[model samples]
Structure formats: C-alpha cells, structure tokens
Target: MKAARIYLSVLCLSLGFLFGFSPAEKKSKATWIWQSEIIGQDKQQVLEFCEQNEINLIYLRIDMNKPSDYYRSFIREATAQGIEVHAVAGHPAWAFTSNQKRMMNIVGWVKKYNLESEPNERIRGIQLDIEPYLLPQWETERDRVIREWQANVEAFTEAVRDETGLMSSVALAFWLDDIPTPDNPDMPLSKWMIDQFDTICIMAYRDRLNGSNGILSLIEQEMQEADELGRRVLVAVNLKKDMNDHASFAEEGVVEMNRQLALLPEHLEQHPSYGGIAIHDYRNWKEAAADMPPVDRDHYKGTYIWRAETIRTEKDEILAFAKENDVNLLYVRIDMQQPLSMYQDFVREAKAAGIEVHAMGGHPIWALTESRGKILKLVNWVKAYNQEVSSGEQFHGVHLDIEPYVMPVWREKKEAVLRQWMGNIEAFVEATKHETNLEVSVDLAAWLDKTPTPGQPDKPFAHWMMEQMDHTTLMAFRDQAEGIIGLVENQMKYAQSIDKKLVVAVETKESHEGDFITFYEEGRGEMNRQLQLVTKALEGYSSFMGQAIHAYEYWKNGKE
Candidate 1:
C-alpha cells in the first residue's frame, strides 16, 4: 500500500483562493485603467505596489495558444498578497471549436487554479472572451451570428465548470446588435446566451461607440437590458485609444480621463448590476500609480522565517523538491539583525527554487549585546523585518528563532531572562497577528518538553512554545532515536487534545548518526525514505498532518 505523506495542501480543501472569472482584465486596485499599459519592471515590485495600495483585483493577459513562465511569478505573488487574478486570452472566434483538444485545455486551466474544489476555489469563474474589435478584417470571415459562437462558449464553459465550479462571464462589443442587447434581431437569443453566464461585460468602448456614445451612457443602457434578463453586468470601460484612431488615455487624451472615471459610480447607481470594471492591461494600470493614493506602508511590513537557503536557490531545485517530496510548504528565515536589503540573494534563490518563503525575525548575538546608542538602529531592524514579511513573497510567515539557552545550573535565571526576552517577542507576535493572515510559527528550545503543561482554549503556548506559533516544532535530535520519537509523539498528542497544530521536526544532523546515518552516507536508498518513515511514525501517534525537515543544506547533502 502506498503511504501518503503528511502535507497541508492535501488536507486543506482546494478552494478558489487564487484566480476567478471576471469580464474585465484588471491588474490591481491601484490600476485606474485610464492610462498606460505595460508591466516591464520587477514582478515582485509591481505586486508590492498593488498591496501597498490595497488593490486586490488583477487581470493577466496570456496567449491562449502559448504558455510562458512570465505569469508564474505573477500567480505566486498574487497568491502571497491575497490578490485575485483573472486570465484573459486572445484568440480568433474560430479557434474555440467544439473539439476535444480545446476542451482539454479548458479543463486543464480549471485544475491548475484548483477552481473545481470546495470553498473559495482559486478561480471564481472563466471568461468566454470574444474581442470583437480584434475580429477578422472581413465580416464574412468572422462568425457575426452570436448563436453559432454561443454554442461553443456554452460547451467550453460547461466542460470546465462541471469539474471546477468556476462561474462564467463573457466580454463582447457593446453594439446594440450584440446577443444580449434586446434590439439585436440577428440573435434576440437572450435565453441561450444569458443562461450560461453569471455576468456579461459590455465592452462599451472602441469603434463608433467610443466616438459617439459616452461610456457611462452605454453602461447604463446595457446594464438595464441585462437586469431585465436577470443577468449581472460587468462594465468594460476603455482606459486606452478608441475606434476613431484617437490616442489612448495616456498619450493624447489625458484631460477627459478623470471625467470618465467620475462616471463609474453614477453608472453603477443607474444600472446596479455593474459587477466591476476591467482595465485594458496590467502594465498600464501599474504605471498610473503616480496619480493614486500614497502607498500603504503597513501592508508590506512584517518578518519572514525560513528553514533553509536551498529552498531559496533555483526554480528547478524548488520544483524538484516539491515533486519529489509531494509538498510545497517551504520555510525561509528572516534575521532581524540583518537588513532586508541583504536577503535579496536568498529571496531570489527561493523564488528561483519556486519556494514560497516566509520570514522569522530576531537579533544576532552582536546586535543584542551592542550599546544603548544602537537602540534606534535595533528598533529599525524590527520595523524593517515587519515590512519585509508583510511585503515579500519568498518570506511566508513570521518566525522567531532565538535559541532558548540556559546552562543546567542557571536554568532558573535563564527562565526569568526568557520571560523578559519574550516581552518584546510577544509585542512583535501580537502586532503581526492583527496585520496579515500569513501563518505564524516559531522554533523553540528542546527544554520546553522537560515538563508539559496544559494550554488554554485559545492560548496553546500557555504551556510551551506552541503558543507562539499557529504550529511549532520541537527540534528533537542528538538524543537516542527512540527517545526523540517519543518526545515528538507526545507533543502531537497533547497539541491535538487542545485542537492545535503540532509540527514534528527531524534534524539532519541526527540522521547522520547510527546505522541509518551510514546508509544515508552510502546512498543505499532514497533520503526521502527517512522523511516518509518519520511522517508515518508520527501518524501512528496522533493527527499528524505535516512534517518540516531541519535545514536545506543538510538535506541536500543527504545528512539524517
């Protein structure tokens, strides 16, 4: 029988946590969709700009025929920042045939975003995008009859949504002749088209519409017609050039931009079904940040705690690790003594490794012992740690890794010092708790297991270090193998009794000792076997859900 590895992704319901269906292709809230459309800067930096501005919605343009890694970082960054993204693809209406290959691609996207699962699945819905402006030059070549196109749209939507539960929407030219428009005689077919979608975005700009009709007026009219059919409306107002060969909002027509924006709320009031707006391009909206509100400082302020530098190395390494280990939960460290600027190499490494790292903050021995004159610098270190964790993707959670040390004779005095030390630590944890939903975990001293105490309902750490983390590990190694196993098992049971998560940590340093150590050194079997066994052993004791290896370097070296 195959043994399942302990992992959070497996147990947690695969809900729509990332992408969703929307008529508009918006990159972020800071994006005004009025001017500019090119995202050439660092992906993380642009994403940070969004977080700081409290922008959660984003639209990414990807080729339906070709796939690339450019969107990988965008998706990762969006997931980390809790931003929801929708994908828009450009293809001729002819490409969406009722064939099996196209059917498979649609299903693949649904699974990739995990939209077919329970709860807030990654994708809220899919878009049946028909950019009429990009239509074939000859009207005869393009299928103008909305009925023919509607059949394929509904087929593709059903195939993808039946498995993923993603809602569906469509984008179409706002010509009075479009399918949902009541006056259109060619396809007065509202039932067939409207039934397949949760919403429809009237592309109320471009061509004669942009020149003759104001955007707000078009939105009001389409929304009224959509509501009459009991369908939701998503307004696609233009932020760029129009059908009249006029310049985009940025290049030539800057003055009338804000005037157009002021009409959005009024249009919504006029036609309440307006779901939201989708900007033309991501790069354009990001460039317009200069005219928006001040960047939000608190949004990106926090600390990251990592488990290894290897998870920070390269994409192949990260992906290989995930595939080999059947897990993607990566740990990264954020040292409070080191400035966040110094961790770029680590962050880049992790990003390359495809590892989503969080941070852990604490001072080095040197900084903690420095004179009082360095107090302000010390405070800045704390603040910067906060900012980086709150902003950085490679850094996932706030981890405090201060080795709990006390000589056997000075144990009492050390405990008092720990209490005093934790005073600042407590403030840091509490401060972080209020800011982000990122999970918080800590590495505590082994001595917390010397005597176990009961944890309160909400306060698990009341008895030990587990209180400080959403889940925490007791680095148990260097002792006898059986003893090490026993300690971890006990913690798991106790934590489970209190309804808290317990992480079983295995040190690679210990795996290097004894018989298994010699086998590990000789490469007799898979290093993953050790990982699998420990995970199985813990599962034998309590509700074991996940396992965290000690260090990336040690694991890479095949050490126990």
Candidate 2:
C-alpha cells in the first residue's frame, strides 16, 4: 500500500511538470543593420533611439557634407552609448587623394573614438567608399586622379595604424572583375590600389536586371572571382532596394536583415576568406523597415523553400518531419546535373506536400559546358507555360555552379574569353526575369580563405564577381573546426554588420578521422549536426538568407 502510494505521487509529479513546463519563446533579436540618414538633430535622436532600443551597431557617413564637430561628437556620443561606430567616406571630397583635409580630419576623429581596449570597443572600423560613376565609366586623366588618391589614402591609413595599431580598411569600386580591363592591359592602377588597402570591400549589389533581390548568390560568385585577383577581401551589403524595388521583400521588409543574419554564420562555416559586411547606409534600413509589414514566419517559411528538388520523395520526408516537429521552413536543393524534365514533377509534388520551394539550378557551369545553351533553352521551356507556370511558380532562382578557374590557360584568357562567359549568364538571367519573374542565384568555391597557388595571379575570386553580380551562394560547411571557426565567425559577423544579402552554402558531407587529419573521410551525421549549429549561431545578425545545402542528392543520401 505504501509502495503504491509513492508510485502514484511520482506519477502525479511527473505529469504536473510535463503539463506546466514550457520552453521559453525566442525573443526577437535585433540585427546590427542601423540607419545613418538621421542628420543634425534627427541624427542625435536616432542615435539615442538606437541606444534605448538596444541597437549596438551604427553606420554613419562623416564627409565634407557634415561639419567636423558633427563627426567627432557623433563618434564620441555613439561610444558612450555603447554603439559601435561603422563610418564610410561619404562623398568624393572624403576620398583619400581628393580631400586631404577631410581625410586627416576623419582619421583624427577615428583615432580619438576608435576603441583599442577593454569592455566596450564601440568604434569597429572606418570605410573608404570608392564607387565609380556609371556616367563617367573611365576618365583618361582619372587614372592619374586615382593614383594620387591611393597614395594619400595609404599615407593616411599608415598614420592611423601608427597611432592605433588597427589596420585601416577601404570599400573599393564594387565593379572591376579583373585587373587591366581587356581594353587597357597597361592599367596597373587598380592592382596598385588593391595592394595598398588592408582589406578590399567588394560591393556586390549591381545586376538588378537579373531578377531582383537574389543578391546573396551574386555576392558569392563575385567573392570567388575576386579571390582570383586579391587575397584580402570583404563584401558590401545593400540594405536597401530589393532587386530594383519591384520584387517585394519578405513581409517584415526584413529580407536584408534575414539574409545577412543567415549569411554570416554560413559564410563562417564555409568561407573564412570574407572579411565582413560593409552596409551601404543606416538610413536606408531605417526607411525600409518602417514600411515593412509585420514579419509573418509562416509566409517566411513558404518563401524559404524556392527550390525543392526530387520533391516527390524528399518532400514527403521533409513534410513528415516538419509536421511532427511543427517546423515552418525546410531547406531544399536542385542541380542542373539532374534532368530538366524532373523539375516539373518536383514542383508539382512539392506543392502537394505544402512545401515552398527555393529552386536553384545547381550546375550552370556543367550544364553550359555540356551544351553551351542548355540552361537558356531550359528557361525557354519553363517559360512555355504562362498559366500553370506563372512567373512565381518556376524555381525561385538558378544556382550557377562554377569551380575555381585553376588552370593557367584559363587564368590568362580570363577577361577575353570570360567576357562571353559572363555575358551569356547576364543575358540568360535577364531573359529569365523578363519571362518567369524568378531570381537567379549562384554557388561559389570557398577558395578565398587559402592562399592562391604561387603562379596564379587571380586567386581571390570575390574581386571578379563583385563587378557584375549582386547575389552569391557560398559554401561554408567546414567553418566549425577550431582553427577555422574564429575566421568564420569574424567574417560572418562582419558580413552581417554590413547588411549584404548572403547565403552560406553548407555542405551535406561529414568528417571522420582515424589515420588522416588533413584528409579525413566525411560522414552524413556530421553534416546534419554542422547545419544545425551554423543555423543556431547566426540567429540575430542580418545579412543571412537561409542556407543552400551542397547538393540535393547529398542531403537525401545523408538522411538515408
């Protein structure tokens, strides 16, 4: 009788705990994307607003346009308020060569406000903006002008380093895929400028015509390409404008925020080569978010799955998991290596499964190499149905699969031959948007983190792709290792802080070690664990846009 009474008590207690206990709901963490448009009185108010609202990262433009005291006071105030100051040279006058007074003035303020020590490192870094005007593509005398500016900028940076020991960085012209444009082989100025700067910021936010808002994949392609030309690299995130503002953003207008947040972790996992993100301006974010609809995670879940490959089998597996677990989003992958005919069937099945698809054409390089115009023709075929296949029903984007161009022959002919290579893609993307209204995306090699082979000149590829593309899908699967994780963290943190839409391309491969450390075998369980960790780590920061698993087949096999 006593034993029965004890058992009943224990059962009641267990039931009580089970019924009463609930996991804490996730609080919305604010990303580092901030507004810089608040000027004069408005600026001060916004800074205070950020502080009150717990905004830790702040972006500002301290140029000739603003008074000297304005910048000094702004930095000082931001520091006191526990906000990190991320500033950019606003106008041409702030350019190192053109505006000596302004350059020195800004450097002095940075030195005063830039943090070196203890509890709060409020001032993160200074950004030297160098976006070229489209109207004046190249100036005959502009080369000389650039040369002068480069020298002064280097000197100014050296002065800052001497004082603070913190290396100064610059945001260079986002365009310029390769040095010595095919037209002017003698132009060493670009290369010279690249060498002078501590880190190169590739602005990967052009290519608006190729289906707006798919900027992360474009950034990845550029990062890989830039790896060819320069070693030290970072990327810029455009917090404003979703593919020219025609294609709408997620309800929260938090597309950039989500993209960067997701990107930083994934990039850290795959590519430690990235420095971080250089946000365009704080104001753009402020304005965009205000007009944004309240975040609907349900709709977010729907938009999240744009490419669901082999949905008939995979969709059911994913749906079962999502339903059982009450998960809203499911990561999907598709490859060009797979037959084009399978796409329609996959789409139909995915829809039935109640899964949203984020389809990326897995292998553009392989497909193009195999038939030259196969992808373009596939787009044509998809466009054949204007009804069932309204623009939205087609895959969310195409994933361009390009391996690092390691061959010397390929390197030498980069600009001349690759002009057509890029042209074909640009044309294909433009035509696709015109027809399907779907965006195009691409995957890039995580090659930038390593040094280029001694003989290769264009090793850092981000320098190349930044010139043309806006979206990038980066492979960031190996970043969790201790040696690599720090690099990954810093790079992703920086990317998120800057506000670019970046997707960390995670690999479904795993690791196993017995006899080999450097070349150990990979496993499936490890890949799944890595994905969960990467996603969890990148929760709050902006600049992340979901993730791209290495391949659909790899993921499916790993589960099996």
Model 1, global lDDT = 0.47
TM-score of 1: 0.42
How many pairs of residues collide in each model? 57, 74
Question: Which stretches of candidate 2 lie above 4 Å from their native place?
Answer: 1-57, 63-83, 93-98, 112-122, 132-137, 179-192, 206-232, 239-253, 256-270, 296-560
- Report the lDDT tens digits of candidate 1 across residue range 105-193: 65466556453333332544556565434555425544444444555676667775675555666665655444342245555343445
CA displacement after TM-score superposition, residue 99 of candidate 2 (Å):
3.3
Overall lDDT per candidate, in order of appearance: 0.47, 0.47
- lDDT tens digits, residues 311-357, model 2? 54455565555444333333345443444334544443343333445
State in Å the error of residue 342, model 2.
Answer: 26
* Model 2: ten consecutive residues of lowest lDDT: 21-30
TM-score of each: 0.42, 0.39
